[model samples]
Target: MTTPAVDADSQLLIHRCVDCRRWIHPETERCPECAGELKAEPVSGDATVFTFTVNHHAFHPAVPVPYVIAIVELAEQPDLRLVSNIVGCAPEEVTIGMPVRVLMEQRGDTLVPVFARA
Candidate 1:
């Protein structure tokens, strides 16, 4: 089993069950429905803002205040959602059901998935 692949344009890491064809997040070793093997794969960056919040309080020095934190539904699956920041635009411009695209950002040792207006 190889490690997951990400960091490409319009790519987000997801695990797909080989047997059931179900997409899983917070990854599990096997498919809960079929007990099948899982494969790490990249999904198209297309998504929609399901919900969001604008943080006005600074929590970290490097992170600026008034950032948009959102729950976005991936285009691959109905319930396939992830927590990500809305970027490449202002926080006030974000809205529910707004289309967004994935963009990877380097934070420390990890590549974080962020979204921008599509």
Candidate 2:
């Protein structure tokens, strides 16, 4: 299948090592060993729910309670994961190792990547 296009302004979901050309994430100043400049760029934003937890209490009244939060592993870099909220499904429906994809969340002008079941 063809991959979707991404714009330049998006944060690098993972770090691509300048030396070894390997991908890493959560933003370090540079490659852990190489010390090369780290550049944040667009990623396909596809991932899988490696693991998750469900919360039944409301932290914010405006926000809904009984939500499932998870650490999703990006498809391109298995080790590159991000904490995201699982939506479009009930909290109890979440499961380990479930397939998910990216959904852009608007915060001011920024579009943060969130995940939902595929």
Candidate 3:
């Protein structure tokens, strides 16, 4: 639905400062680096698992136990990272600094970004 994600549905939706070209995770009116205008942009789905936590406690019936919640650093920038889920594998298989690829899954009406082993 989101146009291949544009690159085979592997693109991650984010915002970038038009002036400084700095990627912003939470879009704002002005860029933090240069006060430039922010615009919605798509980035390469390439990323790495910066950190993760496996939840064994079930807080919701819809979500299964032992799911991986991770902070994934985007390949576009050194400090660029976002919170996402690791899928297509067991939670024990995920590790810090592990290479991952983004996938936009249909969650309700939104195509939420999730990561998988690359």
Candidate 4:
């Protein structure tokens, strides 16, 4: 099957089961809850920092040190979260419950969704 196209202006898309009304992450063809067909749906792109860690050591030469890697919970639903890097601010300034908005960045041919302080 062909992969779904993601637009640069679009927020992250999740799969929603029409029958069960359940949201699925990582984009799947079938709903895990009820064997139903799934559809791609756009999210609000608003989130809160659930937890984070500051990486002080540069893992790669191209990447700078003192960056933040965080798990942010979507405002739409509980447990609907994504692992992304927090940008537009200092790593030490990041905190739990901090409000954030999605910012798409082009990495090669893919558009990755990162978060920035709102």
Candidate 5:
């Protein structure tokens, strides 16, 4: 099967290869390992903070300083992770192995998934 283009709604789904059971992020047409068909699957949205950094500089004018940018590992599989912002708490409070859950925030027309302390 062909991989579909990721959009506002589809971003909630994680693509995986049916044959090899390999997870594909950012979406892809074919499985890199086994050339298997890929399918979009829903995740539980539970994750843990694998690592993070508190950015003190504002790269954009509207964004506040000292926001936590973290790599959170999903509960579904090991090493399956996404880069997202840690919310619902202070940036300094975020730590490695911290439990988190996904929360969708409306950004423009899209709902961006962010992690928050669980």
Candidate 6:
């Protein structure tokens, strides 16, 4: 018998501080609050664009010009937010409170979290 494959949605795990009820991003060594050991937990993929900026200037040659990067507030916790990009739409279209969902991008051996319009 073989174990079933886990979905891409399952791979976007984040840690939440039990004592302070704060969510911590991946690669964090210590909890920003309560100074407790953070544990991995599942999160809802739903979020709303909290704020964003349209960058038309590229410092790197590989990156395209005019892209929108945003900080989104998770539906589960309004205070818990993540930095993601708004894709599949024009940069001018991104606005605060725009609904978005998580998408994964291949970064070497890791799947980095990104977001697209919902």
Give stretches of model 3 more than 4 Å off. Answer: 1-10
Instruction: Provide the overall lDDT of each model, using Cα atoms, as 2-decimal numbers.
Output: 0.85, 0.72, 0.83, 0.82, 0.81, 0.75
What would the per-residue lDDT of candidate 3 be over residues 1-118, giving only the tens digit for each residue?
1222323454666788999899987566799899999877888889999999998999989888889999889999988888888999999889999999987788676677898999
Candidate 6: lDDT of 86? 85
Off by over 4 Å in 4: 1-5
Residue pairs in collision within model 2: 12-41, 15-24
Candidate 5 to truth, TM: 0.85
User: By lDDT, who's the top model here?
Assistant: 1
Cα RMSD, model 1: 3.4
Candidate 3 worst ten-residue window by lDDT = 1-10
Query: Candidate 1, 53: how far from true, in Å?
Result: 0.7
Error of 1 at 85 (Å): 0.3
Off by over 4 Å in 5: 1-11
lDDT of 4 by residue, 1-118 (tens): 2222355456677677889887777567698878999887877889999999999998888778889989888887788777888999999799999999988877777887889999
Per-residue lDDT of model 1, residues 1-118, tens digit only: 2223474553677899988999987678798889999997889889999999999999999998889999999999999888889999988899999999988888887777788999
Question: Native-vs-model 3 lDDT?
Answer: 0.83
Pairs with steric clashes in candidate 1: none
Ten residues in a row with the worst lDDT in model 4?
1-10
TM-score of each: 0.88, 0.80, 0.89, 0.84, 0.85, 0.77
lDDT of 5 by residue, 48-69 (tens): 9999999999899878888998
RMSD of 6: 6.5
lDDT of candidate 2 at residue 43, scale 0 to 100: 72
Backbone clash tally for model 5?
0
Output the better candidate (2/3) by TM-score.
Answer: 3
